[model samples]
Target: MPGVEREPEGAGSARRSLAALLLSMGVSAAFAVAFIVVVGLDPGITFALLAALLVSAASAYRVLFGSPRRAGGITVGRTVMAGALATLVVFGAIQAIPHGRDHTNPPVVSEPAWDSPRTRELAAAACFLCHSNETRWPGYTNVAPVSWALTDHILTARDTFNFSAWEEFPTSARLIEAAIRDGRMPPWNFRLLHPEARLSAAEKEELIAGIRATLGG
Candidate 1:
């Protein structure tokens, strides 16, 4: 019993190190989900980024501790982490920039050219998504980083010509007609999801004429 040997101190250090790494990985994972849920970020992207973070942190730790089993893996992991972090930062900044507008259930300030039923229908179908207070916000709108882009587009569109505040802004009939004629107002991206917004040539002409008559172009 007197000659029994004790395990080396290095073994204890290695065990502690592994425990610390595992704890860190668990914390990072929990935070990642919290970030996605709290901010309403795209879950797929967030999970992918979280995986990258775990891989990178693990690899970096291995490399620093002189584990040469997969040196190249460590390099790749660091690169992925850097790129992902940069992307997240840029998207985060965009989201943080307030456009000084709130998406509220505000009272309708004015009405558009309701001279004809079809005219009203066209406006409701195509222009309401971004230009009116009755925006039917899509599920995707809640998910960033796409949400950031969508919000910015909506704010800009409203600022240029808000149909809800038709009287206050008083947009010209000619401009409205031109926007539809040139396929500009309801941009292509918008039409991708809302096929109803994609007006045919006849429909466009009818809408334009209605706008001209109603708004006195």
Candidate 2:
């Protein structure tokens, strides 16, 4: 250890390294923001980024500042074993939960009214743009950060209310009405890409009627 020579931070090298780091950080942050904006601009991407950063920072701190003795305690073998056991426990707990019971109730209509084929068609067309249970819109769902959030929204929305399985939701009418009235259902960014999904005044009315009929309102 005494003979080891530490590399000195030369002025030019230090400046170049700092500049490169700053540039990289700026580019990463910009990409993150742009990706999120392209998505719904909802709280999802921001929250996920915050969570990832926090976890990353914590891991970095542990790696950089933790005592060597403690670090040694977590040997590769022990780490693998711990990870395996944790995964097993998680899988077991998940298996114990009843199928579909882990999720919230699917959207439903209270009473059945005259079924409007138009409304069902429109809802299927619009909702599937983002909430498609089988296939999502091309290229949209694959982008990073944006994909992260969109994937979550898609899964949650599909679980709560999948238009493909429209008849299953119990409060389908109320959900449809709220989604239209609040202008939150179609998702603003989704409209930008697929204008067809954007609901017009007449379309919204028809959609509401359809939802009402389905729910027996």
Candidate 3:
């Protein structure tokens, strides 16, 4: 070929930017997926985590493509990346604590003499996972902090009133009736995750009435 003007070496930076941008996106996306898998659906903490992730991603984008001005001795981009890396390390280390990964469902020694089959069905559908021996642990319950929270909640619920262990039922029936009637049995967060626990007006009424009849309100 005839001698022609060669492209400048700086032109390679464009290709570098493109590759780095894709890598940034891939890393961010992978972190997001892993975060959810590890932390489950805690709205507050998740939102904060995502906000930091967004800031880190934005800073990375600016460094890769936009003009990243030096602020102090180091740039803000590196600071954010360092903070995020530290957070990941701390969370990763938390997994080794082994506090709440116990998915043990003790034997169903007894059960309440449910007023009717429908009552039992309703209870099982809405409240059993946390309040009974037959809990079907979800995937998030296998992780660390999320597992800890869920395990604590479930244990507390069972202690309060376990339908599967009705042999030791230790509360007044009025408490049960009030819990259902006041729309407090299924907390908002639980309903957010469990659609079946989102009872309709009629269903709630029926369940409430059934609990009273079964437990002697």
Candidate 4:
């Protein structure tokens, strides 16, 4: 016991490298989780991406910094496994939320009966996602965090306008035209994701004319 031999005072290269990996992963994961939580994101979607990111980062680190020995491999594997488990839990929790999985198009009660086929076509192409019963929910909407935000916007938009429920508004044509002219209807943020909603000057004018004629303002 008195003549015990010591290997070294400092950790080995492999141990040091493993420590670095864990430190990096921890920092990155903390930032990501904070961002997701702060934004009120659906953890399911955000965590899945976070898991993938962790795996990718580990792989990149191994490649760049040289592969770890058995201990390091075990460490990485355990971290990845933990990440996967976290993702699954988040996803399950998200599935239990209301309207979380209601990305399907609801039944149309009665769309505004358009007098002009051209106006109908234009509306279908540009405003359908938000202003109609027929919403083409994108693949991304199937995911949680994004789905939540996008679904909220669509619901709010429908509540505001809803060409399908045009009869209720009475002065729908004037309101719609004014909103479009001022570039406030489709909204700039919506247009960024949905380029089709971005109308040209001429297209806007034509759409206004068509709406006026159809609704008889």
Candidate 5:
């Protein structure tokens, strides 16, 4: 009888809590949408709202039921082993791919001048900041959705112009100069974070000179 009497009030309390939670979620979603809009991020407000909801749910769960403390040694060991295995698998797959047909036989420019030390260094200093397999500043680059964008951009840029395989492309010195001068290459947003990649007036002149020298212009 005592338990039965408490059931009705318990149900009412649960309903009230759910209503409050939902209201709070709604307000949080609205705020996220507004913030994303103000920031001018692509994909609009829905992405931000969803991200906020996920974070809120995680926080609520953690608060209601405390998270288990990690056994640091075991966790670190497991992570290191997983990373090593993944690296080996990736390396093996890359090595197994047909290098001749997939790489060597691809359409190439075949200009020795394109592979000159000056040209390679210039590409590394300027283009590789956002378009190479080797990334320099990579702390925030590993974080979730932002990492996704960075990875996609870098991969796409590399596919378009792989500096290591530049001799294969029908690239010309003029094309390179024009791409850099017009601010079409290296991308605007990428330059925002890597200001050193932003070509200075003097550096741009030097780059153009180097390209012209290579092309015998």
Candidate 6:
């Protein structure tokens, strides 16, 4: 083994750098996705932001360092790492946005004189949460954006035909009956969480009939 010239260690170093670079980029992408999801952005926006992050980071890496055939992996790794940090910054910015945190339920003025206690009971189970002042705020209702949309919806529903306010006879009786008949009163989203609010065909008919009866229709 006297002066047998060995090939330099350049290729091995480059291979290791490439491996580390790929690992960093994969981790960055995962964090960006998780961050976007956990912050509660809808799928469309989340995907858009993710694509932007990856493309921008990739382009930046390519600009700073030439083709991967060279030792460009180090530059790629740095750019992806920066992208992950940028996602965290975006999360913080979203959290700082104001509005959609009100969790108060106003006092019940007077309830409707229902045709029967069963009618009131059914309404309580299915509709009163949003349509009355007796709303039971769940944990997610406290979160932003969701809270914003839900509160707005609740306010609008209450305005439509609030059992809490209780006028002489609600003009919404026909609309309410129609919605219940069509399986839209409680809403699928509401039933998803409160299974008790789920209505059967027979029960829907009963609710519709009772609402019409209550309104003297």
Highest TM-score scorer: 3
What is the lDDT, from 0 to 100, of the residue 82 in candidate 5?
38
lDDT of 1 by residue, 1-217 (tens): 5765997546655555465556666766775766565443457766765666566655555554455233322233343454355556545555564542345545678876578988878888989888877787657575555565566667677778788888775688888988887887777667877899988888888888888888896
lDDT values of the candidates? 0.67, 0.56, 0.71, 0.68, 0.53, 0.69
TM-score preference between candidates 3 and 5, better one: 3
List runs of model 2 lying over 4 Å from the truth: 1-29, 40-114, 131-134, 143-146, 166-169
Better of 3 and 4 by TM-score: 3
Q: For residues 99-166, could you state the per-residue lDDT of candidate 3 as single tens digits?
A: 78888899897888888999998888888998899999878788766787688778888999898888
Per-prediction TM-score, please?
Answer: 0.58, 0.50, 0.66, 0.57, 0.48, 0.61
Per-residue lDDT of model 4, residues 1-217, tens digit only = 5665765433464566586577657866785665464434556766665766566655654554455464444354545554455556655666566764687766676666677788888777778888877888767777765677677777777787677666553346898898888998676666777778888898888888988887778
Ranking by TM-score: 3, 6, 1, 4, 2, 5
Name model 5 segments beyond 4 Å from true. 1-119, 215-217
Which of the predicted structures, 4 or 6, would earn the higher lDDT when compared with the native? 6
Minimal lDDT window, size 10, model 5: 99-108
List the lowest-lDDT window of 10 residues for candidate 4.
70-79
Candidate 1: regions farther than 4 A off: 1-102
Question: On a 0 to 100 scale, what is the lDDT of residue 180 in model 4?
Answer: 89
The predictions' CA RMSDs to the true structure, in order, are: 12.3, 10.8, 9.3, 8.4, 12.4, 8.2
Clashing pairs in 6: none
- Candidate with more favorable, higher TM-score: 1 or 4: 1
Please provide, for model 5 over 33-90, each residue's C-alpha lDDT reduced to its tens digit, 9 standing for 90 to 100. Answer: 5434432234553465355455555454345334513221112233334334443444
Residues 12-111, candidate 6: write the lDDT tens digits: 6667677766776687677555544444345565566566656665565556555545653354456556565655555445556565566678788888
